[model samples]
Target chain A: MTLRRIFSFLFLLNILSCKTDSEILPSISKEDIQIKWPDYFPQPEYNFENNSLTKEGFYLGKKLFYDPILSKDSTISCGSCHQSFVAFAHADHKLSHGINNLQGIRNAPGLYNLIWQKSFFWDGGARHIELQPIAPIINPVEMGETIDHVVYKLRRNNAYKSLFNKAFMSDSITSQLLLKALAQFMGALISTNSKYDRYIQNPKMNPFTDDEKDGLALFENKCSSCHPAPLFTDGFFRNNGLDSTFIDSGRYRITNLPSDWGKFKVPSLRNVEVTYPYMHNGRFETLEQVLEHYNNGVLQSVTLDPLLRNGIALNNTEKRKIITFLKTLTDRDFIQDKRFSE
Target chain B: MQRQHTLIFIILFIFFKMKSILKVSLITLIVIIGFSSCKKDRKIDVNTEDPSIDKPDNQEKFGTVSIVFSSKAGNSDLELDSVKYTNAHGDSLTISKFKYYLSNFKLIKDDGTVYKQEESYHLINRSNGKTYTVELENVPVGTYNSLNYLLGVDSARNTSGAQTGALDPALNMFWSWNQGYIFLLFEGTSPASQSFNQALSFHIGGFTLPYNCIRSISPSFGSQNVLVTEGHNSTIFVNTDVLKMFESPHLIKFSQVSESLGGAIGSSISDNAANMFSIASIQN
Candidate 1:
């Protein structure tokens, strides 16, 4: 071959190799990322505009959430503090322990469809959902690392870099990029297949037991104001008359107000059965114990919510009914959601 | 002798042509250089060192505006040395620490086009302990006719889904549990209180109106135009008064011991500081 022909052949070879980069092209379409929900539920708060939900981003987020590689020590991942089976919240511990056995002040909350949440943390200290993980990553008592450090660590690992490149369109790995990936993962974790959701959508499909029916009534009258249906939270904070003497200072620590002294973000009761040791401080060991606090053990105060100022009066039978009702909120499909596991 | 004369004549003729060509090239190069320098001057808006004439774009110019944050009143560039803000009772108070939230920041142009930043929320904590200025970058370059900035976080983002960037809770600027943001955080000690908790920490943040302490600034550029460059050369100088930051609405020395009281007092301090800035004062 002549010199020009040889050069042309080399150029064609380069083109053939470059075509391999698009091999990992997504097989699943946008329709697969659609979240199925019950008819009774209100419109989902997370619109997924910037971090559009996709199978690729979801799997990437899931891997990062479960993988210990996101941490500094490579031992504690997001799953370490927020376990999947236990409603994503840590159990058997009052406060979440992190790298080097660093203990945080509040319990690690359950990870779920965070797109709906306007704020995060028991104190609501984190205003944005995307910024939620940064607290633990850099907190001395948590992951104990900087975002810049996290990016450096992630970039150095071929697995993470490739995963990021797959999840997002770029491999720059800025804090913004890292955060957007996490948001995609957290945003896609929708839980709408609970039994209660089914019953609400079509009573004939899956009806609630009489005991559960009674319990739900009591819950509506007593708990429904704060833990509103179907997402289970009104997405507001209140001093639920848990304790007058608070060492945690709860929401007041963030708001810097006297009225918000004992106020804490009303937690969603979706997986109340499995997410044990509940409350902001993880004080109650069981659902029955938490009921007792709401019934008879409520502390009275000036800023105490009027709804619970006198506390809900529940009899033994009523308590059983409420427990049964609370059980309906458990989403087996969510706990067993295979997409969340590594 | 005849050959030498011919050589000399040819040399002089070539030299004259070369000189004429050289002069024309020299004039052309000067004109090109002048035109290039003029274009750069328009680009380097605020730099006084640039001697070229300013031809500002018809659209409002936007550039990075940064305030060097500091704790000491005189330590940084955001400090205000004077003030006057009256309460419902018509009493003026001196604010020791002026702390407030700066949210929903936008730069409106002469044509009524508004450019709002993505994450415009900021808790400007200033007082004796805070004079450090914050730098806002990536502003679109143009000649701004007026500026309208919010003193507190906007109501839309105040209650919305997941947010990133400066609005991150990791910065400690967010009130993690309250389900609301702390727009402004002013912290410092008082002469009246000797105890450790004697220091006042004012966290003034209310997105809703009526209690909204947000102030909009419209400074007069006078005869000159407010220049905005694409690079790091543009500037907006704000003259902050230290005295106006203290003893406002609520006495700084007395109310500074409490967190909320200090926040209320910060209203006056912040309002005064807002007046310290002018578009004409901005210089390179």
Candidate 2:
């Protein structure tokens, strides 16, 4: 009778141990989470060798991205400036509005296809995607919070501690891990599912309209030098002839070279339809104005792009068609994806 | 028969306990042996040319070296925000803050073999007393003649992603908008006024070509050589004179150019700042 009781007790203990083990392991499979991009797209600059992507990490990143706790007074989050609806661009704001109603110098550019970007911001100051968030986070006009205080705040919060533990599997929360988490979410933002992409994949099933087709041809002839297909930006710094005298010497500030004056990073024309109030300083509000600037308003300077020296001549009909083509590049599914929602 | 059954039960319990103890001891023995072999392999890897390699009886082949930086202004010790010091340019200034980065340390032995410290990045801040001494461990036991280190962070680390510890961007030693570390930061107040509030700030940093301020500093030890032994720690005392920064190759006047952020001026300041460090003494 004693032997039988001991065997039953051992069996119960084994069952309980198995139950506890199962509870300890995460329910979500790591394989389910992946960074997917189009086959036609170029190799991304940021390969996730250092920071392996997982569901928990991405979720934690999403949490951090939307949380206002990153700010000094807990007022603004990354989502405040980079709203997902307009492809992560601050729509209608000429300049970024920050803490204490302070105005920033430059417009907050849209955040998408970040893994492909070699550099960040209008001046191309931030070289790495992982280090890009530090610029806005510490900017007195923006978040108005130091990274030390941000780390301290996150450590105090019980919710963040659990999330960080789940993601990094470490008891200690660090800025490296925090930045990595942020990078994971930002790098995963691959927007390649637009109507244009569909049309490229299958011309027969998803045919472009006559106007779009003409616009595509015109864009290829006129704008494809700077804004290439698949990923709209060539990721080069150039002076697009906006001003004769630069109030904001864009790339020159970083390089401190006289030749780099007025040179700003060429922004991706992807989702340019909704990401309005465009240019580095948000000088142009509509696509028509942007096209008009390219057509006739090309100001000459020492650093003006050699290709745009004799500006591309496009008629009104060509401009209209180009706008139609640009609209097809907007990815509706990316903006509405539930995984990226707050 | 009941007594025999109890005896059998006791024997079985003892047998199980002995087996478990034997298994645990076996595991422990394997772990110890594994660690010892790993340590031996690491030692061999670190110092292939060590004299102790030929004589395997000598177990301790590595020692520790500590570089202690003592900041001074002219003849007196540097005191922040209180004491006034006159620079070579004859401008009296009270230093509020002084910080700089020293990285990529390499110790050269008497035999010309170099022992390069991995990830040797240290931020020396005047406000923080703990950062004055940088201790390096696992240095091959030898007589080192000279020490070489970079006055600023290398260009590769500047471009590389988020870093921790001394190179952490949160330390405010980095420029957020420009995306590079401020290698040497000197902020103070002076009576010679041109700027607002009579402030003198020199944020020196640049890693790009032609304007790169990442200077290579090799402080001479004079006649003294750092002797590292198995059980002994060698401490090298280095004196960093702040007045040398103002007047060396270039004379920085507070009245003319009080404030300089990274550029040609910053690079020139870095050139002057490179002459600041000198080896004072070595205690083995």
Candidate 3:
């Protein structure tokens, strides 16, 4: 009887020890979270290696992107300006509208194909994709909230706690983890499968109109040097003869080089149809105005782009064809995708 | 019959003895494993520094070296917000905030042997008492004469992605718009200022060439040698003068330049900031 009792006690102890390590929720597999893009496109500048692109992390990031809790007054979110329908660019607004209805200095650029971007902002201030979101979050005219407070708020909320635990498998919610989650969502925004892409893949299946065909030829001749195909941007800073003197000082603010004055990053023209009110300061409201400026309104500046020194000579018909071509570059499938919506 | 009974009793005794031995061994194994797991967790937490550089053959022979910074304004100790101190430019200022980053520490011995501390990024804030000292652990036993450290974060960390701990972006020492760290932030109110409410803010930062503000500081021990023997902790106290920032190579009068967010003015301030520290004393 004594021997039997000892064996039973030992079995009980084993059971209790096993129960000490509680089971965590099973994480989604890595294979399910692949970033899908076209093969012709260049390699992504950011590879989600440090912060693994799990489905849970991506969803947590998508929730944070739409939630207005990031702002000081709980009013503004990243999605407040970067609407999905317009390819994530602020629709109709010249300047980004901030908390208390204040206006920002620069236009809120669309967030798409972000993994390809080496640098961010018109001045190319933010160097890394993971570090880009902090610019607008703490900007006094933007969200007007500190990152410390944002982390504190997320930690206190039980819903976010569970979401963070599910995503990172850690109880501690740090600013680093928060930024990584944001990076996952932003980097996954691959703007492929546009009409232009389909036509390039199989010209017979997706045919371009006569106007678009002519526009493509014109774009190849005039704009393709800066705005290349597949990605639509060469990612170089250029003074496109927008101004004689810079009020914003553009890339010079970051480099502190006088030669870089009045120079802004060449924006991607993937969804040029919807991402209107163009230019660094959103000076031109329409595509015609932008083309007109490039055609004849090219202002003389000390740091003017040598390509646009004399401006690209284009007639009214050629400008119309270019606009038609720009419309085909819009990815309808991307804007309507349910996975990116709140 | 008596022989049979004695044989059965012997078999039972051996069986009971073997069971007890198994139980004791199992418990011992679990205890050993438990202790080792606890030690592994501690190693992960404290020993995040690179192993190849300062990994001693025997950890028992290593000692700790603590570098404590003492902030001063001219002849007097720096008292933020209350005491009004006059600078070399004759501008009386009441400092509200003063902070900067120090990284990449190297301890040079009398024999010219250099001990490089890995992952050595420290932010020194005058307002926070906790940040005033940085304790480097597992330092090899040596007799050190002098030490070298950077006044600002290196360019590699400036371009790298989000960081944690002392280099965390939540610290407000970072410039989000410019995508670099504000190496030294000195803000206060002075009567000689032209800005709103007599405010004087100088946020010095720039990691790029020609305007790089990452200043390397090697303080002289002045005939003093820091002896780092086994298990003994050595303390090095250094004086950081705030008034030296306003004078030195360039005398920054508050009337002319009250605010320097960044760029050329910030670089000039960082140049003057290079002469702000000197070794005070050593405690072995």
DockQ of each: 0.11, 0.29, 0.36
Model 3 clashing-pair count: 0
User: With candidate 2 superimposed using the best TM-score fit, by how many Å does residue A115's alpha carbon deviate from the native?
Assistant: 0.8
Model 2 ranges off by over 4 Å: A1-32, B1-60
DockQ, structure candidate 3: 0.36
Q: Pick by DockQ: which candidate is best?
A: 3
- Per-residue lDDT of model 3, residues A1-342, tens digit only: 565465445444544443342222244455645688878998888988678788989989999999988999999999999999888989988899889998999998888999999999999999999999999999999999999999999999999999998888889999988998899889888889899999999999889999999999999999999999889999999999988987999999888899999999999999889998899888889999999999999999999999999999999999999999999999998888788866
CAPRI level of candidate 3: acceptable
TM-score of each: 0.66, 0.86, 0.86
lDDT of 2 by residue, B41-83 (tens): 4455545588755543455488889999988887678999989
Q: Model 2: how far is A155 from its true place, Å?
A: 1.5
TM-score of chain A of 3: 0.91
Query: What residue pairs are clashing in model 3?
Result: none
Off by over 4 Å in 3: A1-32, B1-56
Predictions in order: lDDT? 0.64, 0.86, 0.86
